[model samples]
Target: MRNRHAKDITCTILLAALAVSAATAATAQDGMGDDDGLAATDLDLSGTDLSAIDLSGTDLGGATRLKPIVVEARKFEEPIREVPFSVDALPAEEIEAARIRNTADLVGRVPNFNFADTGLSFANTLNIRGIGSSSALISPSVNYYVDGVPLPARVFDQRFMDVRSIEVLKGPQGTLFGLNSQAGAVVVATQDAVPEFGGEIGVEVGSHGERKLDASVGGAISDRVSARLSGTLYGFDGDIRNIVFDGAGNVVRDDKSVREQYSGAISAKVAAELSDGTDAVLSLRHSRSRERPTTGVWLDDPHFPRNAFAPVPETTTETTGGSLEITHDLGFATLTSLTGISHYELDLEADLLDGFIGGAQTGLPPFAFGAAGANVRRIDETSSQVSQELRLNGEIGDRGQWVAGVSGLYSDLESTTDITSLAMANGAYTGRLKKTNLAAFGEVTVPVGERLRIIGGARYTYERQQFGGTYAGRPGGAPGLAAFAESQESTFGFVTGRAGLSFDLGPELTVYGTIARGEKPGGYLFFNQFASIGIPLTEFKSSGTWSYEAGLKGSPLADWLEMSTAVFLNDTSDEQLFTFNPVAGRFDVQNADTRSYGWELTMTARPTESWHFGAAASLLHAEITSGNALIKGNDVPYAPGFTTSLFAEYRHPLEIARRAGSAFGRAEYQHVGSRQIDPANSRRLDAYNLVNLRAGWESDSFDVYGFVENVFDEGYTTSAYRAGNAAGGGGVFAGIPGSGRALGLGARVRF
Candidate 1:
């Protein structure tokens, strides 16, 4: 059945691709023949011939063309085409059109990006170019930032509100972003307070009982002060079902993976003119979010593949953060200071039914199973961090530009877990981890000639970690075994750097190449408590990557068309690998060597005044070059060999009660290739395709829209894990299924 579904999705994707290609061809043909219609209508139509105007005195260069996209991923403002790296910038209009609310929505939209769902929001993992961590104890390879403020991975599940842009920087960013960005970085810039009074309110309703309400308001409070406030409320009834029941056969549970969420944020800014040819601006922002998490289901269960037999699961998470940014402009340089703090907490309870199945087969009685022949696990965690940064930027006689900065971070984390079952009396574990980090970094770019430039950067980082934890367990009401308390401290220091060159062949074309180094510090695993029983925990070492890349970007056909392509190779030593140790019933991290290489191409075009199209494709190859025998030469888990996305939107003027309005329609399709789920390559998920369609009508103040996602209702799995690794005891397979077909309607009002 799964094979059939996969084949059907493949066929649908091919058909959609062909249709979009045909539409683009038709649009281009029409544009070629209708030159008069394409001409500016405001020009004189009073028998004015083309040769009659004097064009010699007019400067019709790039000044009238579309402006280039500016990005901050490099710690300074620069045009994307001149950065010498791969970067995807999704603007506010695109975010709103796609209804993107979280990082999970960025899968195929960004090349070489994927997310692994573990049923819990906080436990979700992000993979970029096959570099990521599956264990909760490890930090993510891809770093995330909001308005220049770094964020912890656990809090990445927050909602997007009043966002202005999202920039995804591919490849290692350690030279500027520090340790956690070995793979890449995601920068989210929210909307700031505007000088004019304006706001928008929106509401949406969708399938599976989904509902959402969002609003934003901003305006000048005084001559020198401005403020903005935004909020969102969203919820959805689950899609999965539970089939387990007692002898009476009454239904016990329904709607297994529901989500309820709410989030809000506010920002204020003050500006003043100062002496010494200087200006000052101060900005403050705060945000909070809460959500009820979702869970997965059994994949090979005898009753139903998408149904669960376990007791209902529950998860709750809360997060809050604030930041302050102050900038001062000097005559020849700019100085900036940033301070940020964040807090996160989570509580979770789940039924380990898969483990109970193995126990029941062993003739375990009801009393021996704890409650209704089942086992349970409960967990609680809290984390907090504070960070500060200071930087200075300046330019030198139009030939060179430089930026230097210093940063510091302090963080604390605590976690506790309890396991209960009739077969085992009780077991518990507690851990506390603290971390401190400091860094100084700088980058300089110099113009070699009129069309050539050289760029170099370096960072020296120091990190310290302290871990303390205890574990205790008891069996059959006997004295507990494998009980101990231990504390350990470690310090690490490293220097990472980057060098690159870029050349402009012409006003419309640029080519560049770069070589860079990235690093991740080593840390202790608090979950490895079985060492008391002589089963030593695996050792982990700091990991580092050397990346080489080349890219070309241009507007080959004019300002209406753009194209970019890049190829990169990464060699990693002491790469951290996370896997389950079934014998010890724990997760461990090991060190290995790996390699990853990929190429990506993106194209965008505006064929006519009302038509726009975009397409992106990526091809990747990742493997464990040297590792444990079980995984050596195997493909990296969750690293799809190929991925692609295509989108098109068209808008036309509409006459509604003679008001100036427009109607627009958009279609998007994404495809992901097959991938392995574990180091042993024991399980693989087939490739799948998704189709989304949207249409809307808008006036100056009011707008209405509707969308359909997963138009074909194709069944597919987003992530999977071995039962032994997830539920403790031996079983077949468990997985998280992707969402089914859904339709939604929405409206917005602007003032």
Candidate 2:
């Protein structure tokens, strides 16, 4: 059945490609001049009054072209269509219309991107081409950056505000972005301070008691300085229910997995122009969020599909950071420097066992109490990072462009965990981890001819990791095992590189191919208390991947139509795999050999001035080529076999409104294929479809909009876990369900 579906999709894509080619060829053949193609005409409009002519609704037939988008995810600026990799650029207007708030909102919009909500904000995960970090302590395979400053994985869930653009770069980016970018990168650019004084404010109301407020203000403070500030606040009530009863036989009405939450962020930036053609920008931001974390519900229990027995599950996060960026231009080269520091903290408490013990103890005496039956877990963690980078960029005559840079990073992290029950206790576990990284990288691009170019880059990195921690037994346990402290350190280094060739077929077409190698450093896994006892924990070895890709991109019909397609094969060795250890009741990291091959297609068309359309699809086949028996032939977790999306928008002039305005509507459809949840491939999530609708009216100074998400109210799971002995004597399957249907209304005003 899967084969049949795959064949059908392949055939459809080929047919679409042929049709587009035919149309382009026909349009090219229909020339409007003589056979010699040297026809010319003279116009006598010297006495014509151009101001009296109305051109508001004129059909220019693709004469007025759309501006080309530039991408900066490669640490350099290049036109998106000419880049030798898969990239997606989303402008601010598109983000607003799509109602994108966080990483979770980006899935399906970009090819091969997926997100899983693990109930806790800090535990949520993102996957690109089946590569992601499963443990919170480990760096993500896909890195995220905001205005050139790297962000921690835990903060990926924060709400976006005053964003100017977002660029998604797929495949390995190690040569330019360094480690932790083995899979890809996401770059977010925010609005900068301008010399003009202006501001905007918006308010939104939605179902489930949702409310949001966002605003931004910016202006010039003096001839040499300009400043800007932006902020956002959002909150909503959850929809899940808790039906379990307490020990007093009274019904517990407190809703579980409720979204009752409040989160806000404020960012300020100041730019100064100094003498000697130099400039500097200082930025500061702070954010705080508190929410009732989602709780997992038993998959076998049909009576409470959206309900959980957990009584107390909550999480709170706080982040503060600042950065200073300076730039100077020399006669032959430009120099840039960036320095930044940030601190992040998270506190979470959840009922791990839920009601497993309560239900099992129904038929037994109430005397059973000890560490062996604990049902609750609480965690607190904090981390701080400081980073610095300096770079020089220049052009070699007229045929080449080059860049070289050096970067350094230092980070410190601390965490504490407590597990206990009413009558039993598992002593607290405390740990501290520190790391330092240094790197130097260089890249150059040279034109071989008028239509061909060659590009190459490489980076060398060195890292050192130090860990110290202690594990303690219950208060009444043996004195020898009551408490112990241990420390360990390790150092490693590696080099990664990329090489590519690109050719311009015409003014509107580009073809490119690239070969790149990406690497990610290894670190110790301290979650396993038993493994940390008596000796230093062994660090997992680093992992690497060699990727080969070929792609074609072009606007054959100019602004009327655009298309891009790419195929890639990635061979990975010592692939990092995260697995649950039932015996240890924790997660552990291991190494495996794997392979991933995939193809992606993206298209956009604006056949008419008032109508626009877009479509993107991805097909992947990723598996463990050689590994342990449990994973050797299994599919990579979280990677679907295929995914696709389609969207259309239309706008029309509104002549009956209070002032000059336009009305627009949009509809989007997305499909996500079935996916596995573990290396063993014993659990799978079924395929799901979603549809969204949005409509709005806008003018120069004001706008109003309404939207409906999950129009059909489909039910599905975003994440799942299987508990063997941890859930008592029998195994239990639990999962976090996806959000249900919702509607929202909003308005915005600008001055």
Candidate 3:
């Protein structure tokens, strides 16, 4: 690992920045106005010492000024600081300024968050607040929603287009979000068409064939209707190099494993005001990606990975979804209905050793392989989900608010797998899973006095799951060989809820405490190496978690300085975990008990109109309290103990062709603590630091920007595991490397 002194120094500097902001706010100019009662839009920036600078609009498509972050952290629009939850909300400006293009782009930007990129989109892993699983098959601990439509895991890491805002709410939210929200929730809101006609287009090209094009158009269809259409086409060429080896263990050729990558997504939304107090919106979206991806690096090298597979691996994924939302406002309350439907499919073709990836078995002659000594494997999967929710929310006598809702969801997933080699241990595999859920939930907040308030909520859920699978045994003269099939069904009922209290310390500050319970559904794994022997595919049980949290949130220095800090503890029961049972010679996903506690802080400030800076950090300790002896007391895999990010941007007013313009420069620094990758604490990846730099010249009509990602070219691992034994037979540790440094330039035009 690199020296740690730099990270410590940066952290100290970030802390100092916060302190300086506080000091500056205390003695701000008389007209600066540190009044907390002032709305965000009412903030007075006139007192700043920028009277000599020409500060019009910072830019055409972006800005450096801080805006009040509004989010649906509780499924409704509200200022972030006003919400009692531990959450981080990013407005459209922040999203674009930070260059967050997709879901995976949020990893280090948020505290206590990490991601493991597994080459394939659907197979990647995500951990938030130290609560998540390394196995992609397990039910998600966190929930993801777009425009109020819940998204399944297969399509959860979606591309962002026309996004208005994004919010990351920590801790259990089962009372309102229901299943798959044991850890937290990620909510995204896209832009809605306005009454005026407007559109924008952007293009970028960079090193390694990195290219992107995005466009959005919106207009008013009628006095009561508006519509928007947005689309993005972007991709990059191979970033990881692969070295091909011959049968004699000699390198024959070198080439990139992933190449010719391309992807595109489009979304359309139509909104109409049906009546005096009723409104409706219809949204539809589709996305597709195709690429020949690398087989993943076997060693720790970030630039080169050895492989013998001649054709590498190919994968294609597609998703289509639609949502319908209707709302009617009564005299004192509002009623809403949301219906969502989506379908996802995947096709993968790869060269493997024993149903998985590895080059060690290439020299072995007994196993069936291609002419070049590589087993051909193929997988095809499809899944569909539909959900409907009806909710009613209203205020109580101007002091309290309440919401109640009921929702139901149904999903079906099916997949088929086959190896070209018929004599392989498993000739073919097929599986199908169906799930049903019905839930009702409600929450109410009542003021106890001028300074105190009480909160309570609950959700009752009924869940049913059915799973069936078949495995075709090895072909040929093997006696008593036949395809095996099995089916199982189960049902469960549970209640989850939250209770909390909020107290106003003053007009500028507030304190809150909350306790919440959340749950995750149980299911069966689709693929296993022991399937031929009929090991029943190991059915994991459902899990639950309890969270206790306390936080302070407010605009300490009015809109100039915004901050939130929280400490939380969580206890989980029957937490699903995937482990290799060497004794049993098969993989097992059993329940385990675990504990996690952490502190999170996020802040943003603008001491002067030209300067905008922010920092986010988290300290965490998560470990297995009770589990298999091999993992007892061990840190959870891939969960970083500490993570932090600091960003500062400077914008100088510019004159371009007699139009409003600005010159912007930004610097971002991120540090991720070391992470454990296995159950026994035997494998730990080193911590790493990254810095990104961006500069641009923006005008009312056009903007051009340049950026350097991973400016330091840091060498790090994206994911790791005990590869050989975990996958097939060649037993050794392996890893996939993170991306290397890259530079790019982009241009955007808007009217």
Top-scoring candidate (lDDT): 3
Q: After superposition, how far is residue 280 of candidate 3 from its true place, in Å?
A: 0.6
Candidate 3 colliding pairs: 724-730
Candidate 1, superposed: residue stretches over 4 Å from native: 1-65, 247-250, 255-295, 302-310, 354-374, 472-479, 529-539, 581-586, 725-731
> Candidates' lDDT values, in order?
0.72, 0.74, 0.76
Worst 10 residues of 2 by lDDT: 45-54
- TM-score, one value per model: 0.88, 0.89, 0.91
The deviation in Å at residue 581 for candidate 2 is 4.7
Give lDDT tens digits, candidate 3, residues 346-392.
Answer: 99898664211343433343112323524577889999999999999
Cα lDDT tens digits, model 2, 1-751, are: 5534543464465446445644653364344345522211211111111101111222333222344566665666666665778887787877887788887777768888877787777877776786766555566788788888888766766788888888888888888788578888888888999989999999999988889999999999999999999999988887766555545545555453465688999999999998677999999999999987656665655554544344457789999988899999986888989898999998987765545333333333112221223456778899899989998888765646788999998988888886655534366677788889899999888888787888899999999999888877675322335666778898979998889988988766788999988888888764545522444455788888898989988764444457888899988887777776455545567678778899988876544456556788999988887776777888888889999887766778894456988899887777889998877676889988777789999888999999998877777888876654333455566777788889999999999
User: What is the C-alpha lDDT profile of model 1 across 1-751, one tens digit per residue?
Assistant: 6645754665565456546654664454445433333322212211111111111121112111234566676777766777778888877877787778887787657889877877677777777787766555678888889888888777785667788888888888988888589988889988876668999999999987888888888777777666777777777766765444443444454454534444555554544444454445555555554444435455655443344335556666667777777677875788888888888777777765542333334444212322443567777888899999999988855757788999999999888887766544467777788899999999988998788989999999999998887777756432456676778888999999889998987666788999999998988765644533434344378989999999888764444456788899999888777766455566577677889999998876553456556788899998989876777898888889999887777778896888888899888878889998876676889898887889999988999999999887877788887654324344456677788899999999999
Name the runs in model 3 displaced over 4 angstroms.
1-66, 245-253, 257-260, 300-306, 353-373, 421-423, 474-480, 557-559, 725-731
Single out the weakest 10-residue window by summed lDDT for candidate 3: 46-55
Steric collisions counted per model: 3, 1, 1
Model 2 alpha-carbon miss at residue 481, Å: 3.4
User: What is the full ranking by lDDT, best candidate first?
Assistant: 3, 2, 1
Tell me the spans in candidate 2 whose CA falls farther than 4 Å from its real position: 1-59, 62-64, 254-257, 356-374, 397-399, 422-425, 476-480, 529-536, 581-586, 725-731
